[model samples]
Target chain A: MFDTERVKLLAERVRPTAPSRTRLLPVLAPLASLLPDGGLRRGTSVRCGAGPHGGALSLALALAAGPSAAGSWCAVVGMDDVGPLAAAGFGLDLDRLAVVRSGPAHWALATGVLIDGVDLVVVAPPPHPRPAAVRTLAARARDRGAVLVVVGPWSADHELVVERSSWHGLAEGAGRLQARRVTVVARGRGAAVRPVRRELWLPTATGKVAAA
Target chain B: MTALPRLLLVECPALTVPAVEPGAGGDEGGRRLRLFARVVDALAEVCPWIDPVRPGVCTLPIKGPTRYFGSEGAVLARVAEVVTTVMAAGPALAGEGTAVGAGDGAPPVPPVPPVPPVRLGVADGLFAATLAARAGTVVAVGETERFLAPWPVDVLGDPDLADVLVRLGLTTLGRFAALPAPDVLARFGAAGARCHRVARGLDGELPGWRVPGTSRHLLAALGRDLALTEHQPGFWGGASAADERAAEVLTDLQRRLGPEAVVVPVLEGGRGPADRCRLVPWRPAGTSAEDDRGLHGRAQARGGRASEPPWPGRLPPPAPARVAAGGTGERAGAAEVADGDGAPVAVTARGLLTGRPARLSVGGGPWMPVTGWSAPWPVEERWWSRGRRRAARLQVLAGGSEGRAYLLVVERGRWRVEAAYD
Candidate 1:
């Protein structure tokens, strides 16, 4: 006969885990030092708006390097308007990148596929983001161990406004280096609203981010 | 292998299921969801022999399907037949056209045996198939490399492979596939090998196929004078000897193979009730597709959306349904009823019969009678109007398997199973 008592005693009681702590992923601020964490944490989401010379794309490039540097893959989903030339200007290595132009209608499906295996997924939020849908995806990202970055202007009516753990506002361009600087607003648990200014720089000699 | 006519892979999406609408016509999230489900279902219906159903911007592998179907022409016919039947029900599905694996720079291969109406293009391989599908004409074998040449650098768009190819000054599919396998691998590793294989007319991996039993479709043609009862037995039982004037058509189906198929019942206002829009796959022991045709034919003749595809999976959890729930509340159960204290019972006997029923028993508290219920809560946008919103009316909080709170609401009496703690 099987030892039921011993088996029951040996079986560990499962416990529910609390929601993981949120971490701030840093983008290069034109006027400030690199972010404290060096990069965004896995499973975190952020929103950004572009300045005169495409500040949003610039910030994405800085984050892309973090994963590509580790030889991992990164994908951009649901971006239709961003031209290839503009993407290249931000010094993003196209070789390590996969851009999905799903247009506006199929953004959700594309987002679902991209977040499955990629280290980082950058998406432009739906025209009208459903808080419920976003939350579902956020939870999925957490489960899959992937980072999600929402790029575009903030919507007042969006159900979930993935609050900024650290936010950087790009400033107007001033020079060839002008494409880099931005003012960041930071706030969240264990975070403060530091009105810090930072400068952006491209370390690659030819001013182009080489293919990763 | 050289003597065998080059094989072409053609994929036709179900017309009845468009990409944009999950639940179209009258359903929420319409058409889009239905299309995806139908594609999966169609693949399931033709499985084991079809092998693996690959979802990509590329054509499926032809090895397993070709082998099982006995001939290349037979496989093409089977694919076309499924697509044609689906088209009869709704929107016309578009075929992906033909793709061939001709060695580089060869003449276009002609379609043999059963011919297709859609213009087809044969290419040296799958990559060229995708490119040829766009042009409406098939690219022949042997000419794949030469034909793929000069199509622009952006065509080889996979970043890892494309960038390497561009750097090597090899922009076209022909040039990329022409490179020595060893040199390409030495320079680009596994990705280069893949690019080379794709450039050639060969799949990097040989996938399996799972084609299910054939779906049998039944058709019924009847005289205008025929009564609904004459076909009731066939409709419900899926087969019957009805009036001599009526004819039935039957088509075979593989899975969920049974008679008593799910049928969409008409609710008030000549629309299909949510629960009634279901069809069982397999018929009963004695019934066949012939019986199904008789049953479905009568339903269509009576002015309704004819039954076509099989039933879908079970619905998500239900939402609360209150046609008229209203009032300012102050009492303990006042909010539940919503109509102040002692309002007339909104839970009418007829309402109880027409709506989904739920039983609630209060314990450990003073049991107060539900004196009255009122307020047309969350009246989902009036059904007559187009572009109505699907909003649930109730605010429910349930726990998941992990004991996490999940916020769910019923909009318009339809329950949408929402995410946990969401």
Candidate 2:
């Protein structure tokens, strides 16, 4: 009994804007268990830190391998420790990585601009931002379908955390240094509510990451 | 930055040195390039991507970013605003390493001098845009040929190629470009073919990548491979799988993510991480790094400079991951190096290790430390030049276990990490 034109107009007026859905990005086999859906989720930030020895850098590079291999450009901002050659050793395609070494002050804004086009954004954690600033950056990443990987001691309530890292290879004081294995613990944050736990070698003896 | 040319005379070229030396400083355009590049980056705040044509020239594709503005003229006004601000701010603010925010709502920034000479041009192709920019004229969208009709043929940069047309009494770009494509290709060869394409407002046809010295050979190969269909057997007129598929994917991807998204990076042959590679904008399919640079050998042949001499005492492989790239890439803070024992070692002016740190274990065996290290080799080139050259290069390679080595540089009384052996 309703007029067709009136009904169509009512439906259009009440339509809900769908949440942006980003395609899953590739993740290295070693750390696949760390992320939800066994892949690097878009619009999400996964946190990592330095291992007992020196595993933080090795782990960060491992996270980049998958997406860069998938033809997506990745940028590492403010992490002065890692360079193109070391990244190349970790199996990252240097051509796809644009390293922007900005100071602590400009990290958030520079990262926001990079996320617009870049698929993956890795930043060395700066001092915790005010809540409003964090929300703004998170919103930008979500809108652009970019995944932010925060390294170092980041203060934001991160969805994923790879903690209690330990390095193995060198005997008490004799043999050569070799691998990094860490326990990746995940927590529910924002609207996403789910937890995960897994163990993996951030880098094997061959200088590449794989299952522990 | 040109405002501080007197500062540059002090030999502190800093980050803008790369773009500044050859383009602006080389006496070619006598224009501000560092300012031009920064203006483009600043424009990216509103406009998505801009194709930089050289030191004095660049084009913003208004069709894309103009949607955010009320009209195309608004977008042009915003670009012109950035150009004037960057140009007026001078080169110091252009600091190429980090992009400082182009804040709209600012708590007082530097004063911007009035810029009246900055020009913007709109047209069908980049070449036309450049011409219009030079004349400070905006060509209508569809009337590129008409706009170009009255222009002289010498507008083409290549004089040898343009002279043939001048001799033929063809004064305008419209007259030369209107000739048969095949006849133009046959008469003037490859370089002329490019000029003809530009004249015809078909500037989009030129290869996107910067053509190095191997260009003559690469151009032929590109032409031959583009239309080939030998791989696909069934189709009468089809492209082969490897050749066309790569180009097709490259172009298709470029369309979606802007031109800067898809690039071919070429590493030039040289020492020093920063000096080793030059980034070329475009790459042909199946282009190997070995074949990437044919120009370097020719330049070397002409100059036979010592810059490329085998740096014997230079650092080993596994170069430092980050070179700051602006001002001085090496941070003044992270300049110290540690020995095997995790102790900081003092490097004497003679480039010798003053106090060797404790011998710690290296993966395979006990670390064997060197009793004496080599002297710091000093490199000072172009002592007479007022600017645009390295004043000194201090290199020393020492330390590490059996398989590991460290290369360090001492510049301006401060130490720096250059490269290291794996």
Candidate 3:
């Protein structure tokens, strides 16, 4: 294992940089494909679809489970539907979750404050947020090395977009509503230079989310 | 060698307020505490050993400070004068030149409110010092016995213990303290014993009553590690300063917004998404971290559980991130339930399910028909309780071209999407 290439890579890793902006955070194994780096890239933003109550919220919980379970603090701001029972079921370590349900006017400000200490921040963007304000929060998240997950009605500068989500468990009737299979499309002008598409089960029948 | 330490208790009114309405007494007490803190911080040049007991109540051990000021009474007068000056000059000190008839173009400075009553009590023990302050009097050194004798036993502040003492005809502190310590303990219990101790002015010489964080005598009380004792009083000052500042900022934020505005979500055991977690006010530095450890050990104990068998019907892991406990909120989870493209779904008795649901097409895309599905998992919870619940969890694959899936639940005889697999 003592090779010149390994040494060179190790040297590059140790090279000095702005500390917080470079910290890497974990994402659930199933949600890896949704990110450009196959993991939650600190200081970047990702947009996911808002589902029919359980849709986006469940996926967001699954995405946050990896980092939160690994002891990284996650904050869900302006999101109320995701109750503690659902959050706990998603394998999210509840001890580390800070749900900032502050009003609409204070969501962005609360997100900014939270990003400084937490590893991941999932927030529902206000109905109409000015581009400048969104950019400021993204920049701040990047500066603080936190992953910013925007849920619901957002179309702007994001590193990736996980959309076109469809529920998988229920049929017309006479059956149990169980899993969900969603389409993950990568679209952004940043690291994801080329668009990539992948299909996934946000959660399988066993109550676990995994990539297909 | 001399014995007990002299303690001063500063008793300020409006320390605690009753909750009458919005922005009521409790919050104003906090504001008053900050004003008191500001006054104390300004006087840090003289009084260094100040310890806050509660909002507007603090203990100032004046033994060393009195040495510099010449006498105990002199020290008291100095503090009173400082309080008067600060109250009078507060607005003038607040910048912006906003004063009446100011040359600068701005609104006039408001008239300063009259200073609140402050009682200064000097005694040998905390209980006695507090009592002395509340009475707005000072007990001369070693005359604490006579001063305490005439007061009612109710001054102990334990109403239950005082009640029994009154019934037993031990009407005054002197009569109460006259009883043998062993007899009081056998008769009245722990609180009564504590009352007996407070009555006797023996607190200053008591083993635990020494001035905290001081000279060799105090260090000896801590079982002083002689080698590490000297010159390290402020060892953790720099680190603690930043931590304290962070705590202060969070405390200020909690005050500005309603306590619920900032919350820390803690997971508790429960059967459904609604019962599993609750919000507690957030503190950047709180006992919550340690509290979570205890919660982790007792993670199985659902919040507010009474005497009932634990319900085994719990939502499986990979809990939904957002569970709309109530069907309606800022973000509605599953308000309307239908089967197979806007068609209502019905769950028949004996665990059978049948219904037609609506189709969902986002962005004007073609409707994805939910084609195939599995059996219904019906759950009836808390049958023993008055508000029992019944729901059937279902799973189905929706997309025709692509095999997409979603999780739905039929509760209260209606079907709504609970989660999705994608």
**TM-score of each model, paired residue for residue:** 0.30, 0.42, 0.50
Interface RMSD of 2: 10.4
The number of clashing residue pairs in each candidate reads 106, 6, 51
Give the per-residue lDDT digits (tens) of candidate 1, residues A69-139: 44344566555323222233343333334555455654665565455545567777776777776777777
Candidate 1 lDDT over B1-422, as tens digits, reads 12212324344322211122211243311332333234334543443212111221113334445566885556556655764454345432222344322343333333322333222334544456556655655555466656666575456556766876678788777777778889878987875575566566453221122111111000111112223322232453312332111111111111111112111111112111222222222222223345345345334533442433332321122111111111111111212221223332232322221222121112223323321111212333445789664443222221111111111223333333221111
List candidate 2 stretches off by more than 4 Å: A1-22, A51-54, A101-105, A152-178, A181-183, A190-197, B1-422
Please report the candidate that would top lDDT against the real structure: 3
TM-score of chain A for the candidates in order shown: 0.61, 0.78, 0.79
Which stretches of model 1 miss by more than 4 angstroms? A1-36, A50-54, A83-91, A153-180, A184-197, A202-205, A208-212, B1-71, B74-422
Better of 1 and 2 by lDDT: 2
DockQ of 1: 0.01
Q: What is the C-alpha local distance difference test score of each model?
A: 0.37, 0.51, 0.58
> Which candidate has the highest TM-score of all?
3
**Candidate closer to the true structure by lDDT (higher is better), 2 or 3:** 3
Residue-wise C-alpha lDDT for candidate 3, range A82-172, written one tens digit per residue: 5655565566776566677667866776776666556688888788887787888888877756788787655534434445555443444
TM-score of 2: 0.42
Off by over 4 Å in 3: A1-22, A28-41, A49-59, A83-91, A153-158, A163-181, A188-192, B1-257, B264-270, B277-318, B327-344, B349-351, B354-379, B389-422
Q: Judged by DockQ cut-offs, is candidate 3 incorrect, acceptable, medium or high?
A: incorrect
Q: What's the C-alpha lDDT at position B178 in model 2?
A: 82
